[model samples]
Target chain A: MSWNVGVWIASLLTLAIYSFLYKDNPFYKVAENIFVGVSAGYWAVVLWFDFTWPNLFEPLINRGNVISLIPIIVGLMMFAPLIPKISWLVRIPLTFTMGVAMALVVTQRIQGEIFPQLQATFLPLAGVSPGVLISNLLIIIGVIATLIYFYFSKEHKGVLGFGAKLGIWFMMIAFGASFGYTVMARISLLIGRVYFLLHNWLGII
Target chain B: MKQTLPLFIVFGCGFFMIIAFFIPLGGFQDVSQTFENWYTGVIAFFVFVGILNLVRVNTERIQKRTRDWQYSIILLIFLGIMMVAGFFIGGREGRLFLYLFDNFYIPLGATMFSLLAFFVASAAFRAFRARTPEATLLLIAAVIVMIGRVPVGYWIWHGFPSLVEWVMNVPNTAAKRGILFGADLGLISMALRVLLGIERSYMGGGKE
Candidate 1:
C-alpha cells in the first residue's frame, strides 16, 4: 500500500465526499467548501501566470508594447463597481467584451457549424451500394424532417404532421443514445475512483 | 456620457470584427489578433473579481454566524494556502501547488462528478417508461446503445455494435444538425441585434 501522505489525505477526502450518499453531514460540507476554495485559488493562479503576466504585463513592461496598456486600463475599469461614484465605468469593459464575443459567435457559427452541416446533409445519391444508398437517403430525409418539425411558422397538418412526427421519433432516438453515453461516462468515472481506492490506497487489487 | 460611450465602443468593436472577418487584408488581421489577445487579458481579470467576491461573501457569512459558518473558515484557509503555494513557491511548477491539485483537487472533482452516476441511473429507472411508441423507441435505442458499448454486448450479439453505430451516425447526426441550424440562426440574429445596439439589456438598466 502507498504510505504517501498526499495519497492518504486524498483517500480521506474522497471518502468524506462520498459519505454524502448516506446523509448530508459536516464532513461533506467541509469537503465541498474546500473544493470550492481550491478551485477558485487555482483559477486565480492560472489567470495571473498564464494570462495577465504573459499577455498583459510582459508585453507592456518588457516588450514595451504601448497598445497592451489599452486592455490593462480597460480591465482595471472592471473594478469600478467597488466604488459607488464611478460604477458605471464597468459598462465599458462589459460592452467591449460582449461586442467581441457576439461578433465571433456570429462569424464562427456561419463558417464552422452552419455551412459544414448543410454541405454534409446535401449528399449526392447517384451511384452507391444498396445499403449505402439507404443510409444516405435516411440521413437526407431525417435532416429535412427534423427541420420541418422545428418549423413553427406553418401548422403541423397532413404531410407536415407526418414529417413532424417522424422528426420527433428521430430526436427521441438521438436523445436516448446521448443519455446512454453520458451514463456510461459517469459510470467510468466511478470505476476510476473505485480503482484508486482498491489498487492505489488499499493495495487490494 | 457613460451609456453613449459604451454603446459607441460596442458598435466600433463589433463592426470592426465583422468587417475584418470579410477582409482579413492589410493590417486588419494583425489588429484583430491583438484585439483577441486583449479580450483574453480583460477576461482574465474577471477571475480576480470572482475570487474577491467569493472571499467577501464567505467573510460576511462568518461575521453573521450563518448556518455552517465554520465551513467558511475552512474555505478561506484552503484558498489562502493555495494562493500562497501558487504565488510564493511558484505557479504550476510549485511542489505544494501541484500536490494539492493532483491529490486534493483531482480526487474531489472526479468523485463529485462520478456521484452523478447514481442519480442518473435512478432517474433513468423512474423516467424510462414506454407509455408511447416514441418512448418505446427511445428506450430501445438507449438499451441498445448501453449494451453495445460494453464488452458483454458483443458476447450477446455480433451485430449490436454496428446497429448502435448506424443509429448514432444517421439519426443522431440528423437531429443534432437540425437543432444546430435553428439555434445558430437565432444566435446570429441576436448577435446582429446586439451589434446594432437594439439589444441594450447587457448594458443594464438606468437613464440613457
Candidate 2:
C-alpha cells in the first residue's frame, strides 16, 4: 500500500532476512552480504567524520595543535601490518591502546563495581521488617555461597562443598531469569518487525 | 627493541593512568585526558583497517571465482554506494544516506535480531527439560519470569508481578553480585599482569 521506495526496500530486505528461517537461499545470502557491507561502510563513515576527522584532524589542521599529530602518526602506524617489512611497528600502537584500556578497566572496576557492590552486600540485619530481614539474609548468604562456588583454588569438601552447592542453585535461578528476559526482548523485536510489515508495508492492520 | 619497547610503553601508559586517578593535580588529569583522546583517535583508524581487510578478502574471493562470489559483487556495490553517499554527498545528513540507514539498514538489522527469537524458542524446547533438581529449579524460575513479564500474568494472578520483583531484586542480585565481584577481581589481576608484562599472550607468539 505504501508508495515510498524506502519503505519498500526495507520491507524487501526484512523479508529477505526472514527467508533464512525456511532455508539458506540466494535471497538470504544477498541480504546477509549487504548487511555486512553496509555495516562496514556505515562504521567507516561514522569513525571518519564523527571521530577521526573532528578529534584528530580538525584539531591539528584548524586549531594548530601540534600535539594531535602524535595520535595521527600512531594511528597511521596501524596500517604497518599491510607492509610486511615494517609490520613490527603495529605492536607500538596496539600496546599503547591496550595499556590505556586495561588501566581504565582496573580503575573503573574497583571504583565502580567492586566498592558499590560490596557496600550494598553488607546490609544491616538488625532493625528491619520480617520480609526485609529475610531478603537481606538471603542476599548475604547467596552472595557468599556463589563466591565459594567460583573458588576453584579450594577443594570442594565439608562446608565449602555445601556452600558451593547452594551457590549453584542461586546461579541457576539467576541464569533462568536472564534467559527469560532475553527471549522476551527478542520476541518484542519480532513483534515490532511484524507490525512494520503489516501496518507500514501491507496496510492490513 | 620491539618486545621490550611495547612492554615499557604498556607499563608507562598504564601506570600513568593509575597514578593519575589518585593525583588529580599538577596537570596529571590533563595528561590522562589527552591519553584517553589519543586512544580514541588511534582506535578510530582500526575501523578503516577492518573495512580494508573486508575489501581485500572479498576481492580475493572474486578473483579466485570462489563459490558465492557473485554475492561479493553486490556487497561491494552496496558498500561503495553507502560510502559515496556518506562521504562525497552531503555527508551523514544527506537524504540518500539517511534513507538507506532508516529503511535498508534498520529493517535488516532488526529482522536479523528478531529471527533469533524463533531459534531461541526452538532451542528452549529441547534444552529446557527438567532432568535434575537444578534443571527443574531453573525451568520453574524461567517459566515464572516469562509469565510474570507479560500482561496475561496479571489476569491470572495479581501477586505474580510482586513475586517476580522480589525474586529479581533479592536472589538475582545476590548471584549477579557474587559473579561481578569474582569477575572484577579477575579483571584487575589480569590487567595488572598485562601492565607488568607477565601476560605476553596479547602480544602474540613470536621471538623477542
Candidate 3:
C-alpha cells in the first residue's frame, strides 16, 4: 500500500510535468522552481558531507590533524566573498582553482585524446576482412578530406574543396548517428522508470 | 575581492597541481584531496547562483507586470511551496525533493533536449539542398547515418552496420577530439592568465 501510494503520487507528478509539451504553463514553472530550490539545498548538504565537512571539520575534531590544514585554509579563502571587509582573500582560492582546472583540462586533452586519436589513424588491415579493410580506408580518407575542408589559407577550388565538402557530409552523418544513440539511451532509461513505477511501485504488472 | 584575486588563486592552484604531478610534495595528498572536495562546493555555489538568477528574473518580471508575469508568479510559488514541504513536512525522510527532481526537472530537461530534435530535423529538411559537393555529401552521409543507425540500414545493405561504427569510432572521434583539445588548451591559457592576474576580464575589470 505504501509503495503503491508513492508510485501513484510520482506518476501524477510525472504526468503534470509531461504536460509541458503543449506550452510553458504554471505547472511546469512551479515544478521547475521546486526542482531548482531542492537541488540547491541538497547540493549544499552534499558539498558539506563530501568536501568541506569531511576534510576541514572532520580532521580538526576527530583526528586533530592540524598540519593538514593549509589547504583547508586556502579553500576557506573562497568564503572571503562573504566578508565584505576582506573579500580580496577570495582571489587566492579562485585564481588557483581556475588555473589548475585549466591546466588539467589541457594536459589531459593532449595525453588522453590527442595521442589516442593519432593512433587511430594507423589501421592494421593485413589480416582484416575485405569489408573491414574498406571501412578503415574510408575512415582515413574521411579524416584527410575533413582536414582539407578547413584549410582556408588558399581557395578550396579543385581537389581540396571537393575533399573538404566530403568531410562536411561525413561530419554531419557522424553527428546524426551520435544524436540517435543518445536519444535511444535516454528513452530507454525513461522507459525503465515508467516500468518500475507501473509494476514495482504500484503493482500494476 | 576583485577578479584579479581569482587569477592569483587559479595560478597558485595550477602551480601546486603541476608540482604534485612530478614530485609528491610533503603534503601533496592533502592538497590534492582539497581539489577533489572543490567539485561539490563549486557545484553547490553554482546552484545558489542559479536560484538567485531565477528569483531575480522572475521578481523583476512580476514587478514590471510583464506579459508572462503570471507564469513567473506560479514559478515563485512552486519554488516556495517545495522548500516549505521539504523543510517542514518531508525532511530527508521523504522523497519530496527527489520526486520533484526526477519527475519534473528530468523530464523538463529532456524535453529541452528533444526540442533540438525538431529544430535539427527542420534545419536538415529545409537547409540540406544538393547545391555543392559538400552539401551533397552531407545529404548522403546524413541519409547513410540515418539508415545506419536504424534497423532499416541493416536490411538494405550489409556494409552499413560497420560503416556506422567506423564513422563514429574514427573520423568522428578525431574531429570532435580536435575541437575539444583546442578548447582545453584555451581554458588552460585562460586559467594561467587568471592565476597570473594577466586577464582581468572575469572581474568586470575595475581599478585593480
User: TM-score, each model?
Assistant: 0.97, 0.97, 0.73
Ranking by lDDT: 2, 1, 3
Across B144-164, the per-residue lDDT of candidate 1 in tens digits comes to: 888988888988999989988
Q: Alpha carbon lDDT of residue B16, candidate 3?
A: 70
**Which of candidates 2 and 3 is the stronger one according to TM-score?**
2
Better by lDDT, candidate 2 or 1: 2
Local lDDT at A11 for model 2 = 90
Q: Across residues B12-43, which tens digit of lDDT does each residue of candidate 3 receive?
A: 67677766766666688666656655533443
- Using DockQ as the measure, the top candidate is 2
Candidate 3 lDDT tens digits, A43-160? 5444545655665667677899785465566666666666677767655555555666665665566677667776877787779999778767766776676666666688887887
Global lDDT scores for all candidate models = 0.90, 0.91, 0.61
Show where candidate 1 strays beyond 4 Å.
Answer: none
DockQ, each predicted model: 0.79, 0.81, 0.29
Interface CA root-mean-square deviation for model 2 = 1.1
List residue ranges in candidate 2 displaced over 4 A: none
Error of 1 at B149 (Å): 1.2
